[model samples]
Target: MIALQIIARLLDYPDEALWAHRDDLLSALADSQALDEENAAKLSAFIKPFCAAELLDRQAEYCSLFDRGRATSLLLFEHVHGESRDRGQAMVDLLDQYRAAGLVLDSKELPDYLPLYLEYLASLPLEEARSGLVDIAPILALLAARIAQRDSHYAVLFELLLAISGVALNSADVAEKLQQESRDDTPQALDAVWEEEQIKFLSEQGCASAEETAHSQRFAGAVAPQYINLDAHFESGTAGESRP
Candidate 1:
């Protein structure tokens, strides 16, 4: 719902109000006449993933918004790592509070930070860390540094992320059939069980069912999103109204 609210605000708010304060814009959107439960739920479900990414990306966009040196430093760190909280928080603090701390390093010194970044990566959940492996060379490079720096945990984590991301992207035939094991007999050995669970949930929910709505006319393009929107029904929506 938050994503939907943001999209709605972006759509209806005045241009001057667009990039002002996110909190203020969110509040104004909640208060606006355009917002409603159904549309809001749809919007939120669509934008949730991108919103999370955007919140972090914005810090990288504006230097003076935080300590410029630290902000840029954190981005490079994040490109090769992950952490408990969104890395964007560190970027925000660096650019905003330490913008001119006189700590800019030479481009060559960038490699020196790989160990620190790998330590941060190893501290994260494997699935979380793999999300940063979009550019695997830097990730592998950081993993090598981590191994030499007495932080080999990240090397393992980096490999797991790569294996999982690869399985998700390339091994769809095996991924779709969870009944069949990939390299091991156990279900845990399967790389895509997590993704399969989602597909299973959709199948169970009749998302692909051709059954018509018993009352209102069933529309096209209503199945899969409706399944996703089920999660978006929080404390406020048609589904939430049933909660006592």
Candidate 2:
């Protein structure tokens, strides 16, 4: 699960501290016997360019890809509900889930942020973490495809996440999800997407709701914060160290 923790950090907003420890993070992934050989290689390949790039360039790209557009937004519910009231409710529910597991969000991050979710997963027992990862596989797949369409290397992170989940990647389903939304990253396109009205929840329709049941079952057990090494490293300062 340290590998998950490392990947989560890599996916977070770039900073000098993260760049300083880039080698350490890569070393952890490369040395991890837990990661499949292919994924380990893919991960290294994915990160190597970022490590070699100018820090500001890397930060700019991260901001462009993740910060700008809903198509590649890292907030989970944005893909699910856009800017609707349901997203607000889902955020509250997800925050409650985190609190139930004794995690307090001291930072300004919303509960559905993917890196925060990964950090939460890293805190869980391996089986529970894997189960939670599997539960979010669809969202991961959707994001992976979106990034890949832009030819961004960050897609590899999502690929590694989906691989770790041990769920079969459904290309057709991912493609379908992609097709349902506009891929243009323009402000107008984003406004158009957000303009769509919110759909009612499954419970509101009085339908049999497996998703509701799964949500309840997913966070049933609470584990204390045990991934101290990485957590401490993250909290020590900004994300990366300046290059000599």
Candidate 3:
């Protein structure tokens, strides 16, 4: 559905490519008949000012909201599987599913990046896409509540996604959870997180002292990136094949 495609692009980084096509994106949402009157109006209200703002401002806002903490991470799996071996395997499994659906990714994006996942869903039948959203409705709902707590315009997008999913989710439950949760994106919280993470890494890696941790850091080599290379399959001479 065009609404899915539009939202897929909308969730992506606010680069010039998306900015340049803002008018077309709005036009498609209206012409697609995929959204009802209220959703369309809410989305339009968000997109109008979002697109009208200066590019630098938009980029900064995006980074502030999503890049600062794991709370608003756009990686779908990050919310589900944080620093676990199962997450790695799940990503590969998802990549396989994408290939089976003729959704070979052309970029370096992870298989579970929410925007890319939405793009994959956009290529499916409307009901199937809705089902896909429903599969992750709880995540979307928590995201909606969390972003709403931040008083961000992006909450509308999550709310729209949940609305589209048509799931029987409880917004009140999510809000209650949010009420009891402390903010993780604050500078103090981030620093504490890094310190705790270092301690955890040292313990997990058998570093018995600060000296061993320091030595390990001094000798640390290039760390492998955490990504399932979606481009690997195309290396078999099908790189130029059109995506679904």
Write model 3 residue lDDT over 1-244, tens digit each, in one string.
8888888888889998887888987888888666889999988998899999999999999999999878788998887777889899989998998999987789788889999999998888998888788666667777777788888999889888877876555344467656656677888667656665676677797865877566545434222222222222322323343222
Q: Quote model 2's TM-score.
A: 0.72
Off by over 4 Å in 1: 1-112, 135-244
How should the candidates be ordered by lDDT, best one leading? 3, 2, 1
Backbone Cα, N, C clashes tallied per candidate: 8, 9, 0
Which residue pairs in model 1 clash with each other? 4-43, 4-44, 66-95, 66-96, 67-94, 67-95, 67-96, 67-99
lDDT at position 175, candidate 3: 75
Q: Which number leads on TM-score?
A: 3
Best by lDDT: 3
Number of clashes found in candidate 3: 0
Q: What is the lDDT of residue 191 in candidate 1?
A: 26
**Which residue pairs collide, candidate 2?**
16-240, 16-241, 17-239, 17-240, 17-241, 18-239, 18-240, 19-240, 20-241
Q: Give the local distance difference test score of model 3.
A: 0.76
lDDT of all the models against the reference?
A: 0.33, 0.70, 0.76
Task: Give the higher-lDDT candidate: 1 or 2.
Answer: 2
Q: What is residue 192's positional error in candidate 2, in angstroms? A: 6.8
Tens digit of per-residue lDDT, candidate 1, span 1-244: 2222343243221233444454454354455333356544443443343234454354443222212222122235343234436555655553442234333334342322433333333334555433423323333333323332332222332333334333222112212322221222123422233444455566678773433232112222222210011112222222222211
